[model samples]
Target chain A: MNQSRNRLVFLALILLGIGFVALVRSTVNEYILSIINFVGIYIILAVSLNITNGFTGLFSLGHPGFMAIGGYVTAILTFPVSRKSMFLELPQWLANLEMPFFPASIIGGVCAAMMALVVGLPVLRLRGHYLAVATLGFLIIVQVLITNWDSVTRGPLGLNGLPAITNLWYVYPWVVVTVYVAWKIKFSSYGRSMLSIREDDMAAQCLGVNLFRTRVAALVIGAFFAGIAGGLWAHLVTAITPTSFSLILAFYIVVMVVVGGAGSISGAFIAAIIFSVLTEIFRPLEENLDVYGIGEIFTAAILILILIYRPQGLFGSREPGFLLTRDTQ
Target chain B: MASSNSVLLKVEGLEKRFGGIIALADYDVEIRPGELVGLIGPNGAGKTTVFNLLSGVLKPNQGRIVFNGQDITRLRPDQNAALGIARTFQNIRIFKELSVIDNVKVAFHIRMGHGFWKTLMHTSDYRYSENEMEQKSHEILELFDLEAIKDQPAKNLPYGIQRRVEIARAMATMPKLLLLDEPSAGLNTGETDELVKTLRKIHDTYGLTIFIVEHDMKLIMTICQRIQVIDRGRMLSTGTPEDVRHDQRVIEAYLGKSGHGKQYAQG
Candidate 1:
């Protein structure tokens, strides 16, 4: 009871932080708010995907595909029912609809998870690089279909003029929930089973782990979160192209997970924030400096250096709780 | 291990073949409750094959394995494990990347009832199970004198200690039937002696029906209550250690009638 109470107190503190952010509307500028929102979205996607790829040892590269499902689904639902002129390529059924934000977002997430269940069958059968390639193909297939499917989606022209509904209030609560869930998994027995599978599949199976079931559960749960992140992105940016959720975006999310520490949940969050900040700092240099491709070149270089120097990433497999190092003992 | 009347495992006509190589043609053994059975033979004596078949690693061509009075022939490997069959490999197969604590934690997985939802939610069920696994793993590690290296990655441990860690891992499953393949292999004499003592301690404390495959005659002779000798995929004889020591067929099986087995007897 005492431990539960202490944990509840800790969660209250986290919720207070989110509430505090919600109140500081005048002091925080839109530019800083944008960066905060971006970090939240990245953290959600990276940490959620880490649950599967890192902890469960399922190399899924189709996270962007799930996000695409969320983005398209949410965009379809929340578009203004009277705004037909805004969607030239949208079908009559979707253009004539307008649903509230929260329900639409959740439904979007649900659809993405269902799509994951469909894809996970053949994809999870392949291990290591084969599974990765198969999932990458799913991402490409999603992107190409979004670009060409003129009826429901806007096709290559893309969905536009989505309502900007995600504020700091909208994002930080979701972050707390997602991080709470991921961290819990890391310290739990199920988490240990997943880690065991990552270390040795045959041994884990011999120990009574249902290999296929665990992998699919991890993948589907991760996809649900990815979808939720996509819905948040759609509302925050108010527009999305098939190109936004691309293979490159997938690479960036994976980089965040890796540099944060692949198997570390809290590390994923830290890596997301650090990478999001670095991208923002480099945004202007890569944009107006006429340096052309040097910006991406440097980013790739830093990733290579990280892999060589600290392949386990900043935290390795350790979490933020052991940041003081003394607690590690 | 239960009372002697419990009848833990009964194997009859367990046969295996590897593309015309007959590993075990007609293997029969009855492991009673709480009995320590020694499996001995010359090189390629099909001892390991028996261990593999019982532990569900290798399926026999023809056999009936009545485990706990249940016919588990076509069960999944983990299902066999859930029925209280745990094994250690001849070549050590520890989870190399996991810490010594986690190596045992993985073994207690089936005993943990927490699911993905429970884990992700940090429910009481998850916390209780995790704490139980940690305490059990720590205790098992201490038994093998591995408490000092409990936090160390498994691969970093020395080879001999690694083997002890392997046995500790198998025991963490709380198995009713523990199959060990060459537990004394590669251990120095002092280590082998300690290994024998540890095996005895485990049998006494946990009461697991242990079936061990060992090449060391001295170790098996000292540790086992009953010795079963197998030669060329056939059982030579099985009896009390004193009876096996005097059995002529068992002598021919081990010393080849030219007579290393007789050398021990006549001397």
Candidate 2:
């Protein structure tokens, strides 16, 4: 009976969130609404990255690469059929193909997941700095491919003026899904294995946790969500370039996961919102003060301070007590 | 000696080398079901190497490991564990950030055979399995006398309890063969005595076959039905405690020539 009440309360809370999104969508100014959308996108990215870098203890810089793949796939599939033929020469079947944003986004995510499986098979073998470098290499390779694939990607200048369909409704549901899935996995046996791998992989393997499979699964799952976030981001801005998914974006996402708490889902979600809001607030302030790179400096300083004082991030590897109410199961 | 079919673990002519150095050579061990065997060696007699080979951490350069009538020589660590061979490390490797119960719960990974979608969906299958996991984890904690401190982070525990947690985690795997690499390495006499009792209780209760490597002569002599002594990566003697204590070579290589032998005799 008590559990049923908790579930009812949880459902009411979710409905309240949806209503809140609707209220903001109607009442908020365009600038603030854009910021909210950005928050939702970052939540997806940070939470997804946590699966690989935080939970599985892999140091990957390939998130932006997966995002790029997702964004391009969604854009191409959802592009106006008339616009598709005018901008660049796509293959015959792809040229005529037009899809809805939802299915296109899913396809983008699937493509990214497929790429992760291929890349992770070999790259996941490396650990520590080597793994980081290998993933960074993957990011670079992705950028280079997008830049050089002139006919398909239109060279360095990427697909532009995509339909602006990414609103709070779309971004909000994805945000909820990403967090919900990550939360579920985090609290399950699979999540325990991921945590064990992060703590001591050799020990995890000795206990019958398949190290390779678990690590790759983390990467693939993270990549899939990253792909979706990319599609959302591309539509929100209505533009995407090969240079858009740069090392800086990768670094920022890593900072969010690290600052929030690696293994804590709520930590990543909260950190994403905090950092996104901070960056937006700093942007106008920096422009008024004419201080270029001040935002980067501030975030870096915060990161360093966090490392020195509280190396485990805000929540460490645990959730807050309120969020852990149903933990008895 | 036991027939091949009766043995739970059969190792034959196991050999390993690190570059030019021979860490283990021509080692053989046969552990029958329900037997508690001990491996004793000096500091660098490759006792850990044997554990590594058996647990599939290191692929033996030359050997065959047959577990339950199937050859497991080329299996990976996780595969060996799934096949009912679980091991504890010489250095405690419990997940320090996790609670004591969570540490033990990690060992149930292989047995919790559910799909990722089920895990993510929180379906009835997931709820049922998670409940089962919680109950089993609690039972293990109770067996190890850790039920009271199950919620405490493993890192905050005393050294002896951390050791016990590692053993308890290994027990959660429900393996037919348990490879314990120095269970009483850093324990005091009292703690070692307590661990000996725990080992005996679990072995008799579950009919577990345990193969332990330890430097503690008293712990091994008191609990192990058969003990194998190695020197310079080769098997020196295998027999009852009394036979190994009286062997002239064991005295010279391990227990020391005369005075140390007397000290061992006193035990």
Candidate 3:
């Protein structure tokens, strides 16, 4: 009885949130709207990354590689056929093809998920710092590939003038979807398997959680959403570059998940928004002072402080009391 | 059911080695269904090696293991679990940060039977199985007298309760054979006594086969119907607890003194 009531209340809250997004879309200036769009994308990235790093305890840094795949795929599919033909050479079918944003975004995500499956099969065997390094290597490999594939990616120059179809309406729904799916997985049997693997993998195996299969599943699922975020990001910026999805962006997403509390969805949500807004707020200030990377330096300092004092992340793997509809623990 | 006389688990000429050192050699065991058996040995006696082989934690450089008439010598630990073998570690390994109930519910993963998409979509099967898991996990927790602290994280519980929770989690797997490795390792005398009751009650109530490794001689003698002794990786003796207690070799190799058996017997 109480569960149904909570569901009703949650539905109302979601409706109100969408209405608020619509209000901001109409009232806010372009600069503020862009920051809000960035927040939505970061929320997608941080919450999805939490599945692999937070729940499964697989310290991966390859999120940007998956994002790059999604971004490039979506950009290619959605690029105007006239622009595609004029900018670079392509195969007859792909050069002639132009798609709208929605299906192109989904295909980009699917492509990313497929790549994760291929990489995860062997790399997921590693653990801890070794896994982290392996994933970082993957990200670097992706960058080099994009840089060298001149025919398809236009080398270091990258593709530009992508249609700006990514707005609050497009990004916000994906944000809601990513967080909802992550929350559902967190409370499901698969979530339990992932958590058990994190705690003690040997014990999880003895109790019948297929260790390799669950690890790969977490990575694949996380990669799919990252791909979608990449699509949204490529469209929002109206351009794509090989260096755009860099190690810096990867580290920023990791920081959000870590400082938000790795295993807590609400924590990731709050952290992503706070860090995104803070970075945006610091950007103009850094420009005015002619100092570079002030935003990054400030984020690093805050990360260190959180590590020293709140090592479990801000929420310690549980939601705060107000977010609790039931006993999550 | 396989006939009552048929062996539930059969091991023949099992051997394991680490570099130049031998962990076990020519080790053999045959356990009929529903037996309460104990493996007792000194430190470095390869007692755990035997459990490791049986549970598929380590591949044997050796012989065959047949459980319920299927060869399981080469199966992995997860496969062994799916085949109805469950075990607890000598070092307690409950999911420390998870609630006690979640620890038990995790064991039901194999039997939950719903796939990823069903869970994501919150299909009817997902909700039904989840409800079933919650009720069943609570029932198992109640069996171990852990219901009062079900909501508390496993790490916050006393060592005794944590130990019981490990066993409770194993039982939730609904294993046909349960292997316990030094279950009394960190328990005090009072806690050990409580565990003795719990093990016996589980064995009696469920008719489940139990194989235990123990340094606690009282736990072995008080509860185990049959005992197997190993010293330096070879079987020293196997018999009823009373018969094995008086064996001369067991006293010298295991008890280390003739008086030790009498002390444990009286205790």
Candidate 4:
């Protein structure tokens, strides 16, 4: 009975997604559609980062590095031959390459996951703040490399004039997939093991959880989604650069996860949508009203207020169902 | 009575040190199958250290710990668990945020057959294993009289109940040998009596070789068939409970060597 209900809910979601795609495609205002697309991408980023930071209790600030890897890889792969020759200094075989957005984004995700595996082996061993600092260092290193690698990345000039392939059709499906995967894993034994590690490492280990292996797996999975989000963001903007994935973007994603409650997938999704909309709403206030940095100040205020009032974030490590009823009590 | 030749655990010359302080030195222990053994000593006597070494929470500088038939001296905690040895902590270490049922289900993780893909997709095999685990967890919870409160977070339970849940969680691993560290530490006399009954019932039902480190002399004396005494990281005595209770060296270690110390034993 529960399985059939789950299937019903999944079927309803797919139908809703189809309707949403049609709605966005027929909408006349491009600005609203763009905002919706950005929200979808942020949802993926926030939810994926929550898998490691919130669920596994591994505080990582390396999402920007993985995003940079994904964004650049997808951008390079999907760039037209004429555009690549005009901007990028590349090998003959490589310069002539082009692929569809779907496959390029997947390869971008794979590349990011591979990097996560390599970086996670050593960094995941560090606990708490040390782990956070090491990952932050990784983001900085990636940015620096991108800034200096002129032949491949065009150095500080950045890459532009790529196809604007990210829309509701591309972004919404990934949003659904990300939420579906996160929700499924959150209820599975693998998720329970991750949560156990978060609660208590020694006890979790005594319960037969391989700490390093679980931690690494969470990082790889989270990185894969972050990479995909980056690819989407790059195509939506039709440009790519090292600065696109700076510490600031990483901090915003982390804020979304924390403000949504780290371990709660629904919390991340809601928080991402709310924050993205707020950013857009406040954009006019900052630009038209000439209030420089007003949007950032407002975001900081909201975060601080949320921290003081509800330290566990809006959901406090609980699923959205918890709000429908007091099941825990 | 079990034969002395059918040994389940054998630890020889276990020595551990932390910089200048000797935590445990030249410790030797043996437990026959179906035996309930107790290791008792005063504070800082390395009782918990022995448990740490046996469960692979810490490695001894010198020792050979053989459990069942495997040399587990250098094994990791999860590896030791996989080899059919499980333990609880001195301080209650139940996963506080998880429900009572989940705390037990976590222990059943090692035996779970479903891989990542199957679990994510909720394949039929995954459903079967998960249902089996839930049924088994419920049975264990029922055995501990915790089934009613199984859905509540473990930390929300009372201290005595929390202790019971910890042991129940340990039992969910289906261990051949169980090591309990100060299981009766926070319990009152009534709770201690209940704990003793539960331990005996668990031992009998599971046919497990049980080793315990405890300070509650009453619980130990009432349940344990044999007792090993340690003081300042050295072995003081090893004998039947009645024998150790009457031994001069064991009495001396707990009550001191002087005649004035007799009051402690009586008290």
Which residue ranges in model 1 land beyond 4 Å of their true spot? A1-25, A84-97, A321-329, B1-6, B15-25, B41-49, B58-62, B125-127, B134-142, B228-267
Weakest 10 consecutive residues of candidate 1 chain A by summed lDDT = A320-329
Q: For each predicted model, how many residue pairs clash, with residues at least 3 apart or on different chains?
A: 0, 0, 0, 0
Assess each model's interface with DockQ, reporting 2 decimals per model.
0.56, 0.75, 0.77, 0.62
How does each model score on TM-score?
0.87, 0.97, 0.97, 0.96
Which residue window of length 10 is worst by lDDT in model 3 chain A? A320-329
Per-residue error (Å), model 2, residue A272 = 0.4
- 1 or 3, greater by TM-score: 3
Q: Write the per-residue lDDT of candidate 3 for residues B99-137, one digit (tens) a residue.
A: 999999999989884667998888888989988998898
Residue-level lDDT of model 1, residues B1-267, one tens digit each, is: 356676788988889999999989888888897889999887898998888788776788998999999997666667888998888888887888778887888788888748877676667777687777877888898888999888898989877888888888888878888888998888898888788888999999987789989888878888889889898888888887788778888777666666566766433
Clashing pairs in 4: none
| lDDT tens per residue, model 3, A156-269 | 999899999999899989998998888888888779989899899999999999999999999999999999999999999999899999999989999999999988898899
lDDT of 4 by residue, A1-329 (tens): 35665567678878988997897779658888888899999999999999999989999999989988999999999999877887878999889999999999999999999999999998999999999999999999999999999999998878888799998889988988888888777776778888889989888888788888999999999999989988999999999888999888887888898899979888998999998898899998889988887767877888899899998898877775522223222
Rank ordering of all candidates by lDDT, starting from the highest: 3, 2, 4, 1
Off by over 4 Å in 4: A322-329, B1-4, B260-263
lDDT, candidate 1, residue A212? 78
Clashing pairs in 2: none
| Residue runs of model 2 more than 4 Å from their true location after superposition | A326-329, B1-5, B255-258, B265-267
* Worst-scoring 10-residue span by lDDT in model 2 chain A: A320-329
Task: State the C-alpha RMSD over the true interface residues for candidate 2, after superposing those residues.
Answer: 1.6
